[model samples]
Target: MSTYNNQETQEIPLVKKFPKLKVLPHVNLINSPTPVEKMMRSSEILGGMNIWIKRDDLTNSKYGGNKLRKYEFVFPHIQKKNKKRILTVGGLGTNHGLANVIIANDFGIKTSLFLVDQPLTHHVRENLLCDYYYGADLNYSKDTKGAVYHILKDLVTDWSSYYLCVGASNSVGTIGFINAGLELAEQIKKGDIPEPDKIFIAVGSMGTVLGLFIGLELAGLKTKIMGISVLDENLNSTKKLQKLIRKTMNRLRKIDKSIPDVSKKLFERFSMNRSFFGGEYGRYTYEGLEAIEIARNDGIELDPVYTGKTFSALVDFCRNNPNAKNETILYWHSKSSVDLSSIYNNVNYKDLPKEFHQFFDGTVEIDDKAVHCIRKKKN
Candidate 1:
């Protein structure tokens, strides 16, 4: 039932709006109301809509991303349940796993990462090392089936642990994005930025988009959400997100009965784009790399698997709907913005588990010629 902003405590916008929900436990992992600014150069270059950026990337000082926002609700839930460790699964370089470890450590909880196969890249390698550096118990699961097996086995052996789904998109974790939606409403009311007609964000494990969708509707904003799919259509489809949203709404209603059921507004305000998925998860596409270059014009760094693809879809929309005057577009920058060079500097690749060495060694071919991409600008 407490929320902390760094050293200080305050009521989140969601709690302020529904005082009854203030009893729900939360721990702040971010600096609230992440800055929103107009991407002037990007707007002029892209040429259709007035582009704005919601800097969710700066969610924290160490490592920040969309996951940090989710952790706001997730961390407290783990503690309330009295779980001693978090058992989660994701691709080898899961930002969620790393974020989970970093935040969970603060709460004195252990993390066990059941990592499945993904395209190997320097980014993936660095994350493996950082995961070890940060004290995650790395468990290599060859694929999805193996990851599930490991999770099930761990849950049985370790009675105090629980398996949270990927990206922490469950009902409780999703309250983070609901908070974000209300936060954006406050910013718009204060004239920090214009109310965007549409907001473009990546759809991964489905929480971010669904939570934001409900939040905006609850705040009575006319802004629509376009969730560019970064994962498989099976998981990121409209049907799946709607189901999750309903579950989240049910949970919120339990917290506060006055909260309206916005299920009817789902179609009006939400759209999911599976076109940008790059065929499979973890592999970067040409369109996404190009989007990364375009984003650099606005001084934003985006990874291809998620934010890059999402931004590509956003650009396409602006081009496709040219001449829509008075319409503003907001790009949700969800990747981490903090520089982790110092963390990398202190850790040696050799320190990670032996199974992870292939990612750094020449044995594994870097996916998408990722080494070249990381070293120099993509031509």
Candidate 2:
């Protein structure tokens, strides 16, 4: 709701490096140059590296996160094409779908969210309410098969709609994070934080990781991308990352030929750690909860679904790596920092469809011990 979220985009960093990138439509969904600061207590507690955080969580006042960055490029382009509606897919409590609805609604464009099932938690339930609160047409897809049928049906039924893949991982939306990488480079030049030897972040749909990877590459930074896989291997593989990197890089090239191919070196600079994933999407792990508790002491809130698992990997790296204490580390806090207490309290779960009631009514049992604790607290 801040005035800056709607402000005009004069010259983003991506365009600064390659002027031709200005051809792609962009709208400001984030309060850019999001703060970077050292995690002093976290550093001392880990007894390792001087850990720093890129506060991307504060990207917007309404609903900040890495998702907003993607929408910055996506929403404006949707408007340019005169799309009347957006159809997207995600888990039943996907922050990505909720973000899509909230920001797309601001543009007066309707959103239809086709949701598949994931392990339920209070965070997921609140996100579902926000999706409905923001005027999204919601469908409770029991699984991917159901989601596909509904999406296919909707596409045929709704001709004026534009469909975006999960997490907006396609070439266009991916550009926003590329811009994010460049944004980080600019911050480094300004001495906001030291050049990180490694950056830790969550990898779900893979757009964020690929974008940052390419963006850092484009910025000529030597920072390695340590992606924590929050999903199954089939969805978060290096091969899939490469494919999207290829698509996003090629898209940038079409706009500016001066942009170099960073894909060749991506393998050397990128590593995916799947140990913290705890076997499935949305399932919180023991390590993730410990990470959440550690981050909270530093005044940072990370979700069990994404950032918690991510920071856990970062924590483990600091504790386990022999060179960790000698290197400068960065944790890209990608989850939204918004306090949705009022929003969750104001919206009633009964307002959602009959099939959706189970998530809130406690019929859907939480499979993870860490997630179950939060479910009891209802935070």
Candidate 3:
């Protein structure tokens, strides 16, 4: 297998020296060279075509996930703008918000989060408590997705600090995954990974998928990338992804007017298949639960909200696509370890619904040695 360095050297231009590239200063938050592991069991289960995983979950940084990669391209702009605080919008258990809080703290930037009261699983407790422990100013509203725009608009009146949009929807944030696509392409050329027929990833806000689309086009790779939607909005995720791609391409065109207009073709080249969303946002299905168990048994971790559904879709797709059986597939596992200590402090366990009681029942015990009055529940 071939290896490539994922480090961003100082010699590299602030915005990557591409003539059409829009440069933005961003703090480096994720560790470089996350390992790519081939999934043997998953491959066998799907009749063995070669299934692989990109271990973004193992990113050496304390806050790991696909978000950190996006932040690498975001935080620098935040720093350059001299923004003291970041305001973002997400649901109650927002992995994006949690990652922002951790990275912002590292850079000494305060963060305010607007959390919508969306329907979520009772047992899941990853993003909410992490946000609290990281000391993000939290606000809650039962705002539908449309209301989020107005909420942010209203917030600007109350607070003058710059707002960090979730997924960093602009060109700056998209660069992170564009760079990842470049890195993945180089790996393929070096024979580190077999040429994948398909790549599956979860799509929430569209930055990562758009970045991947741009990067693959730039790298001239033919792999088909699919985005599984976790939210149940009627709008197509591909359309949202295309909009971001157009915005990035437009920004690039401004930097170097000489670049060809490939925006229309780029949209056609990047395909997003979203037949996996069962129903509603933040809700789990039986397939998702089965995928979660299979993943855990395979020694990989996934949450039901995002990666679980994406991986489940990938498995089902592989099983259904008879023509694709001969080619390799890739599933992007994009979750990180939960910090139980901080979760205990922020979430009231008693408030959880009874159906989810088993998840936190004896699994999370308070440490008597830590001097906090928190006590472990007797099993």
Best by lDDT: 2
Q: After superposition, how far is residue 333 of candidate 2 from its true place, in Å?
A: 0.1
| Cα lDDT of model 2 by residue, 1-379, tens digit | 2132433465788888887777788887788889999998899899856999999999988889999889888888888888889988999889999888888777888988889988777788789888888888988888888887888888798788888888998888898898999999999999888999999999999989888988898898999999988887887677787788888888888877878888898888888877777777888788889999998878999999899989988888888888899999999999998887788889998998788888888788855565432232232
Q: Candidate 1, residues 182-276: lDDT per residue as tens digits?
A: 99999999999999998999989989988898889999999989888877667566677777888998888987889999887888988877777
Model 2 pairs whose backbones collide: none
- Note each model's CA RMSD in angstroms: 4.0, 4.1, 9.2
Question: Better model by lDDT, 1 or 2?
Answer: 2
Hey, what RMSD does candidate 3 come out at? Answer: 9.2
Which candidate has the top score in TM-score?
2
Error of 1 at 176 (Å): 0.5
**lDDT digits (tens) for residues 254-311 of candidate 3:** 7777554556666465555445555555665567767777777568878777787788
User: Where is model 3 poorest over a 10-residue stretch in terms of lDDT?
Assistant: 370-379
TM-scores for all predictions: 0.93, 0.94, 0.81
| Per-model CA lDDT versus the true structure | 0.84, 0.85, 0.67
Give stretches of model 2 more than 4 Å off. 1-10, 370-379
What lDDT score is found at residue 70 in candidate 3? 81
For model 1, the stretches where C-alpha displacement exceeds 4 angstroms are 1-10, 369-379
